[model samples]
Target: MPPPPARVPDLTALSLLVAIARTGNVGTAAHEVGLSVQAATARLRTVEQQVGAPVVERERRGRRAGRLTSRGVLLVEWAGPVLDAAADLDAVVAALRPARPGEQPIVLAAGPTAAEGLLPAWLVELRDGPGGQIVLLDTDDPAAAVRAGDATLGIVETVEPLEGLHATTVDTDTLVLVVAPDHPWAGGSGVDAAELVATPLVTRRPGAGTRASVEAALTAAAPDVRAPAPLREVAADTAVRAAVRAGEGPAVLPRRAVTGDLAAGNLAEVPVHGADLGREFRAVWKEGSSPQGTARDLLRIATGGRIR
Candidate 1:
């Protein structure tokens, strides 16, 4: 009889080595794995010892900055298949237990405007047509959902790349200042950034995509003006609309989000000069992971084209 199989070593350390190799810095790799720099370094050392070879030449930055030794590359190449299989297994297991055969659930993270305005038409088509299972998660935490694999796709208003995720822009847009129709600034065709900054402004909490664009536009256009204390710092788009409608302060919102209000005469768009104040709406998915079949088809339908 063949001897019993030897116990396999922990692949966690091996995986970290791969991450470090790809990222080129411990800080970046550590963030991707949710590890502290010290812990990542220690793991790297441990893996090197276990392999009995110098797998990575660590730079002062403590990433795999130098070329991987032949042994290290071999270990990494061998481990790649193991990791791929494990990921497939996890995806399969998730698909099996709770979900029924016809219900192929895929979570999508997106901002409220996209969720409400953009996604529904495609979502209905997906459900009624070829695409069967679906769940929509409208959120500001697009990157987090993508990282957790809780979301198969994320539509976010950001140009910055999310670590470990592949991204493409579905749309490019600009922020427009919005105020209640009765407000003094209402009905103005458009104003320069400096003029727009002169009014009291309402803003969302920091890290909101619209907020970030608005702030950047304000800072560049009116550097001499002190940023007015925001009248409100809400999380959701609806709250921001309510505040502006109640005459709290002028608010900046995505053009898409405020289009209906603008047309309905409930709100007015104030122009900000000197700055473009644009944002990129993006679709993000896991690196090297393709959304095949229905998911792919639905994405194509939803986006109108592959991300540019």
Candidate 2:
């Protein structure tokens, strides 16, 4: 009597069906739906069995067409109205949980040097501002993260133009020679190009931004000097720092990465003639993704009035 307890089809299978209809191929649709082609085909068959009707017509290995039977079509059409109602409900719930008066939840993706150390002070100031909530994700692939909408903002070392992201120069930072306090060079505040070349160095992995910038400067300064034999190669700035701290060997690091150590006398910045190796930091975001409210305010605070 109670309205036949309502017929319910598996949403996952239904979603896959919808994707298949739009993409016109099982393999392509499977990829969109995050399933393998064989799996999608099996799931489609199961849905058809549940409804007692075919929902798709297969052409080639991947090519498919929505072949909803009369009953299946009726069900598919009915899904539209049901989904619209669900969407409206979702909107209502989201609106009910509206952002606190001025607080914005912002995510920033950046290189380890800035994300782990440099940005904390600025972030604290922003947090004291009107509702500035921030999360930082440190990674070397900031460009990819920015393009994927994984973060509202990204700080990176290079100036390469990201295709769909807007980039603005933030500041220029230099690579400083760093060595453990016990190292022989520790007595000196710096080293010359010849000293750098002759030293057995602990360096970053090949493609790192710091490494690239240092290499370019090195080539310009002494094209004839052979590349230093690396004592060790590490992937992250933190790893490189730990290696240096272990007295591995002399290493090159960004000023931001070694600033505290330099200040504490744990490590000294080596002076090198014409070795003012530098790179531009950039703030990047999706081209049309405008920051609003708290995010906009936080961006301003983080940039420290230098968003030009």
Supply candidate 1's per-residue lDDT for 45: 73
Candidate 2 contains a number of clashing pairs equal to 6
Pairs of residues clashing in candidate 1 = 192-273, 193-273
- lDDT (10s digit) by residue, model 1, range 128-223: 567455566657778789888888888877666588988876667778788888887776667777776666677777766677767777787789
Compare the candidates by lDDT and give the number of the best one.
1
* TM-score of candidate 1 on Cα atoms, chains taken together: 0.57
- Candidate 1 lDDT (Cα, whole model)? 0.71
Regions of candidate 2 where Cα sits further than 4 Å from its true position: 1-105, 161-164, 187-190, 194-198, 204-209, 223-229, 233-246
> On residues 149-247, what C-alpha lDDT tens digit does candidate 2 reach at each position?
887888887766678888777667878888888988777656677667766678777756677777777777777788757899887777877788878
Question: In TM-score terms, which candidate is top?
Answer: 1
TM-score of every prediction relative to native = 0.57, 0.54
Give the TM-score (vs. native) of candidate 2.
0.54
